[model samples]
Target: MEEFNGNDQAFTRDSLYGTASEPTYAGVTSFMRRRYSRDLQGVDLVVSGVPFDTATTNRPGTRFGPRAIRTASVTSAWERHYPWEFDPFDHLAVIDYGDCNFDHALPHKIPAAIEAHAEHIVQAGCAMLTLGGDHFISYPLLKAHARKYGALS
Candidate 1:
């Protein structure tokens, strides 16, 4: 288990797989625990966020959306929900794979960053549920999905 002394947190290597190398971000396992109550052995769905809004009307903080959503998801976990009775966690595996790190210094890099990041997830054979950094982020996400699944038309 990898232990962090500053936050008094400890997580196994398995829990940290596929997570960013930086310690600031939460691991997939921790995100899953915050979002659902089930083991993630054969999860069918993936919930991800793309917090890279360089083109927003007010662009200063849209990059923070991923962190905000993750916080809210953790808060909502213990709250009562109708689906709780059905144990939705047992049926599905949900995770937040953190956010796509944008190169704010080079705004033009956003499209490629978003495309590559989303493609990694799609290629892993997981369904994506993404939060937005900006509207443009969705375009690359859709394109990546289309490349993987082919165009509907």
Candidate 2:
């Protein structure tokens, strides 16, 4: 078990690696309790939220999916990942990058905003695990990723 120094490791922990020791219910919510940081230095992967749902004409509530997923992940963050004896954090450096910021009013710019946001991270040599807003959001994300890694499947 990891050492428990206090709580709110999402904001308090300084390292980009290791499982958080804070209680699941007591700390700032980040994906799996990973620290919230924009710095890509030494980071292996970034879990970012893209909260835009204007494309989902039939179901517009998908914008809230990212936050809901993050909140739900709080519990799993402190527990051992299933189907494995070890935590991936033991060898990986991950962080929760919060969400993509864009003007919802400017729907045309949303795709670009998400693309740029992804480009910034991918360009920094970091892999992304995005919590999406809608199915359409994948277009921009894939475009950005394809630019870096080429023709994503």
Q: After superposition on all CA atoms, what RMSD does each candidate show versus the true structure?
A: 7.4, 1.3
Instruction: Give the per-residue lDDT of model 1 (tens digit) for 38-138.
Output: 23345566666787766777556767777676655543343235654544544455555656767778878879888998888788787777876767788
Listed in order, each prediction's TM-score against the native is 0.68, 0.94
Name the regions of candidate 2 deviating beyond 4 angstroms: none
RMSD of 1: 7.4
lDDT of 2 by residue, 56-140 (tens): 7777888899899988998887767788998888788999999999999999888899999999999999999999888988899
Clashing pairs in 2: none
Candidate 2 has its poorest 10 consecutive residues by lDDT at 1-10
Off by over 4 Å in 1: 1-42, 83-85
Top of the candidates by TM-score: 2
**Over the full model, what C-alpha lDDT does candidate 2 score relative to the true structure?**
0.87
TM-score computed on alpha carbons, candidate 2 = 0.94
lDDT of each: 0.58, 0.87
